[model samples]
Each structure stands twice: as structure tokens, then as C-alpha cells.
Target: MRITRVLGATALLFALAVPPAVADSAPSPSASGDDAAPTTAGTSFRTAAEVEQGQQATASASTGDYLYWSFPADAGQRPTVRATVKLPDAHAAQSWQIDVYDGLRRRQACQYGAQTRTAAQGAASVDLSCTLRTVRSWSEPWANDPLPGTYYVRLTALNVATADLGQPISASVRVGSKDVGGSAAVDGSLAEPLVPGIAVTSKSGEDDGDAAKSAVLAGLEPEDGWASGWWSDRWVWTAVGGVLAALAGVGGYALTRGSGRPGRVPPGA
Candidate 1:
């Protein structure tokens, strides 16, 4: 009876202890608040506004238009970006492409997955998800390190017909970050969020002087070494908390079982 009671007590304690730890450590679901409205045309990186991680944003564009968005990241963090695009039913099929670029406007390799539907099938839409692995920004001078800074995501329509030139398409974007357990310290800071001369210039080299000035005034530069330190990763701490809680539960169960052994019965008294 004593052994049974001890085991029951231990099980109860473990059940009670584990839940709180898991709840505290697990990543919270991203809020389903009102969609964020995209500000600039987002055709270029310079005009792109910062997107808060895990928040959804909405934008409107035509076929062939390149929509851009910027996200801040740390060196050791892996980020996943997703986009859902809604198109007009007038077209039978369409192709879309999304790309990720680093601070220097260099393209970063990513894994891409997509789902497409035609108007006849129901709604014309495409869902895209891209993931980039952890990057070490300062590892080498010539390497295109996925450094911590403002990263750009550009979305383009590939097969728009001439008749669909002015048709409006809507897009929703979301970004999520996960820590891959790397060094806490970052190497340096970005001098400016807008990539120098790249922001205001069109592919044909046409310049928007006013847009350039406004970008400078926006003061969007993140603090130097902003990605540094272990505390940045909340998930890491949550995982650690869960592990400790499990260990404690096991230890408590063992100790209780040892102590609740009925005192050895005093030699069969």
C-alpha cells in the first residue's frame, strides 16, 4: 500500500510539473491580428519597410511587378518566409517566383515549396514558403554570408499576359524565426538599412532623389551588434526549462520511491 501511494504521488507531481514547463517553453502562436498593409510599392529593397516576425502583411500588385519586403535577423537564427497570392479568375494559369536577398543585395540560397490552383479549380492563388539556414555574417570577407541585418524578399509574376498587365493581385506575407544553437555574439552592425545607392535606383538606373533622402531620414538602422547575446532566443530558454523540469520530475520520483519503502519493516516486526 505504501509503495502504491508513493508511486501515485510521484506520478501526480510529475503530471503537475511538466505542463507548466512545456507551456512556458513552447513558441507562442503568431497573433491573428488585422493584416499589415504594405506601404511602399516594394519594387526595390530601399523602399521596403521592416516586417515584424510572424505578423501577416497584405499588398496589391500587377503581373510582372516585383514586390519587396525587408526583415531583420540575427546571425545564428534560421528564418522561414511565406507568401499567399490571390489572382484574378480571368487567367487559367500563372507562374510566380519569390527570392531572398542578403544585406549586400546578394541572393541567398533557400528551399522553396509552392502550391498552385487555377480559376476553374476554384480560386486562383499560390502559396510559397522559403527557408534559409543559420548564417555567420563575419566568417569571411568574400563569402556571401547570411549576415544579421535587413534581408529582402522579392515576389514576381512570371507569366502575365498583355491583357493582364494592369490587373491587381493581392499578396499576404509572413516570416518566422528559429534559433539553431550557434554563437550568441554577432560581429558588427549595418551602417544603414537601405543598401546605399541601391534603394532609389530602378533597373534602368533612373533615380528617385526624394525617396533616397526619405530613407536616410527614416533612421531604420538597427543598433550595432544587435544580434549578439544568448538571451535573444526565447525558444532556447524554453527548451532548457523543459529539460530541467523533466530531470527534476525524474529525480523527485526516484527520491520519493526510495524514502517511501516502508522503512524496511524492522526485520519482519
Candidate 2:
């Protein structure tokens, strides 16, 4: 089947109506919140080798950190494909695209629509010393095709101006049921969480001191929503206490002034 670019763009915009972004080095998500290491870092996977060969499409744009995606294991059943993209220090991507492929190597799903597209592939795109902006997470649906088999999800970055696919990253999924034009089924595959790990890179140079300080500073800094939430709570309690103290003061003054006053002090006695 000839896939029209217009249809693909339409689908992409529909999916990107709600863009999803998340930071790299975040813990993998599971129903239980546990994480498992990715089978292959920064690459696509498939149940069978033949399937992998078909989805090897590349793009021009690269991601700042990393991208995450998932799909249902059953065919014909709707699959929720969640993805995240982190931006450089102050620079953000103009738009992005997430593509889902069925067993036949056809573009089954897509999510795009960002303004800024980065030229670098990984951490280099952003100055890690400062705050990191990211698209958290969003979902898209897929159809049951190729008779309910394995599929892949490719999250591609696009230049908002030129409408070009930059660098594409992808992951694999299995489809179980036989549904089409609809959603995935219960037999769809779910991923295991990633095992936690840390990367220890050395810093030593004329700028080593600055890099070291920056690393330390980043750790001390709060996340995007952390400080706002904390300060809001603090101010709320402070206001409540102020109101209570004012009420207490008024009560105390009234009691003190009336302590020894005669109740029947008349004017014309």
C-alpha cells in the first residue's frame, strides 16, 4: 500500500496534539515502577531479525538526550505509545515525530509537530550545567496488521521549519491479537523495567573546575515543578498562621481591657 505523506502528516499532528517529553537517565517505567535496562541502548529491536531489517529508516535530526516509546502486544487493540524528549539548557525542539510500524514495514502510527530541532544526537545538544526542559509523555494508537505479529516504534525528531526528520530512534514491540483499523488486544506485549545504573565520566582540563562545579550545582538544583510546589505550601501555612495570630491578639486585648471594669457604670447617677 502506498502511504501518502499528507495522511502521515495528518496522523502526526493528531498524535502530537498532546506532546510528551521526559528527561534522559530517568528510571524506566513499569506497572510496579521498577526499571530494567534497555536490551540495546539507542537502537531498535524486533521479535524476528527479518522484521528489524524492514524498519531501518533514518532521519536528519538527533535527540538531545534520549527518547522512550512503547506499544500494545495484541493486534487490532489500541496501544498507548508514550514518548519523551529532553531539550537543551534553554533551547527546545520546535517539533517531533513518533512513528509506529506494523509487521509489513508500513507506517502504522506517527506523532510530530515541534518547532525546534537539534543538530546534536545526545547530551551535547544541551548544556547540562543549566536546567533541562523536556516533553514528558504522550500516547498514540496502532492497527492490527500483518496478521498480529511483532512491530516497532520509531520516535523521530523533526525540524519545525523544514519539516524534515532529523535523527530517528526506535524500540520493538509484539502484537498478539488480530484486529485492524481499531486497536491492539489484551495479548499485547508489555516491557520490563530497566535496571538502575550510573555513568561516571571524568572531568580534567582548563575548564575542569567549571565543569565540576556545574555538575555539583545541577545536583543541588530542584526540578521544574519542585520549588514552586514547595513554596506554595509554605506560603499557604504562613497565611493561615497569620490569620490565627491576629484573631488571638484581638481576643486577648478584649479580655485585658474588660478584666476589672464595672458592668453597670452609669452616666447620670
Candidate 3:
């Protein structure tokens, strides 16, 4: 069927007026009041400080130390990471970088923004940002789609002069997200997010970071108007496509169906 870009887009905007149903809405630990203040950065993923969306965090450390911070992301939300580094003055040109990893440690591709930047020699500060694609409820194993879960942001220096090895520097980070509503949501959803479990040592001292899973998996609930009755953005596109196809079919039939009926089979045959 023939369709125009304008019509397709119009249908989409109209369809997006409605949202999708949320399977769960309980807040994640990172979103709770327990972490009312910004948490400190961890040296690694295991110790990474947790922060809420839009909350800012500051850290002081050596030029070569790796700073890690984590935040939660729900389906239909696109999260972005912005970081600023206070480079030590009098330092040689160096490359500073920020990377985001998912629960399975898969590196997420930056959709836009300066994920890495090289500070000119003697530069006082360097700023970098990375915006990731919208999170999906579930994805195929072959696809590297972003999923709802805890995401980590790791910032470090790619190269630095030896003289700057122990130089102290200050850094600040902020993680935020914007809900796309149901525009990007899929038909299916996960029962809960992929929150990794922390290993707690036992009183008997038998296990220590070896193995055990206890963290409860939780899904985000849709907003007030997005109950089960609402529809996803995909449905709008499907409905529009179907309408266009039907119109095309009718037009084709009308054009081909001649005004003159088949000359009545020669009266006698």
C-alpha cells in the first residue's frame, strides 16, 4: 500500500497520546528516601555509589583512579550521563572518558553527546556527556537493546603524564532520565528489573562474595493514566498502516473494475 511520511508521522503523534500499562511500580532501593543525599562514588562496580535520577554527586580522587556511580532506569525511559572533571592545572594533554555498563557488564552505546574528550594541556576542567537509547522491557539475546535495570557510569583518564600520576582532582557526576511514555515500549514486559544481588558474608564465614541471590526484582508501574486500558505507540502505527493498505486496495479495485460490465456473454453462447 502507498503511504506518505507526513501521514505516518501524524498518525504516530496521535497514537502516542495514550501510554502503556505498567506491570509494577514499587520503588527501587536507589529511589527510596534511604538515599536522600547523594552517595559517594565507589572504586569499582561492587562499591559503586547509588544515586537517583537527576541527583548530583561530587568526588575527590587521584588523576588515575576510576570513579563509579550507578542509577536505576525503567522501561520507556531514556537515561543520560553528564560528568565534569576538574583537571589538575599544569598537566599535559590527556584524554578523559566515560562509559556506561548494564547489569551484565555490557557496555551501552552512546546515542549522542561527548562521551570522551581530550583536555588541552594546562586545561582546568573537562566536561563529557553520554546519552543512551530508551530502555526496553525485554530484548532478544542477539540484540544489545537497553533494558530496565541498574546501570553504571565509569569515568577515568585514558592517558596522563607521569608527573600528574598522584595529582588530586575533583569530579562531579549527574545521571538523569526522561520518560518517552509508551512510544518505545514493546508488547511484552519483564516481571522485574535485572537488579544484581550483593553477596553478604555469613555468620559461619563459609561464603564471601562467592555466590547467592536475594535482591527482589521489581518492575516500574505505569503512570496514573497508563493503566491496562491504554495502548502503545506501535498500535498507532499498525492501525495507520492497516488503514492505508485498505484504502489502497479499494482504490486499486475501483480503478481496475471497469465501468462497462463484461459485455454480457454473447447472448447465445
Q: Compare the candidates by lDDT and give the number of the best one.
A: 3
Model 1, residue 28: what's the lDDT? 45
TM-score of each: 0.59, 0.29, 0.65
What is the descending lDDT order?
3, 1, 2
lDDT of 2: 0.32
When superposed on Cα atoms, how far off is each prediction in RMSD?
9.2, 23.7, 8.6
* Candidate 1 lDDT by residue in tens digits, 76-110: 56778888888877764567777888777888878
Q: Give a tens-digit lDDT track for model 2, residues 165-255.
A: 3433333322112112111122332231110110111233244655544432112111121111112223444565565566556555655
Worst 10 residues of 2 by lDDT: 192-201
Whose lDDT is higher: candidate 2's or candidate 3's?
A: 3
CA shift of 16, model 2, Å: 42
Stretches off by above 4 angstroms in model 1 are 1-41, 115-123, 183-225, 229-269
Better-scoring candidate (lDDT), 1 or 3: 3
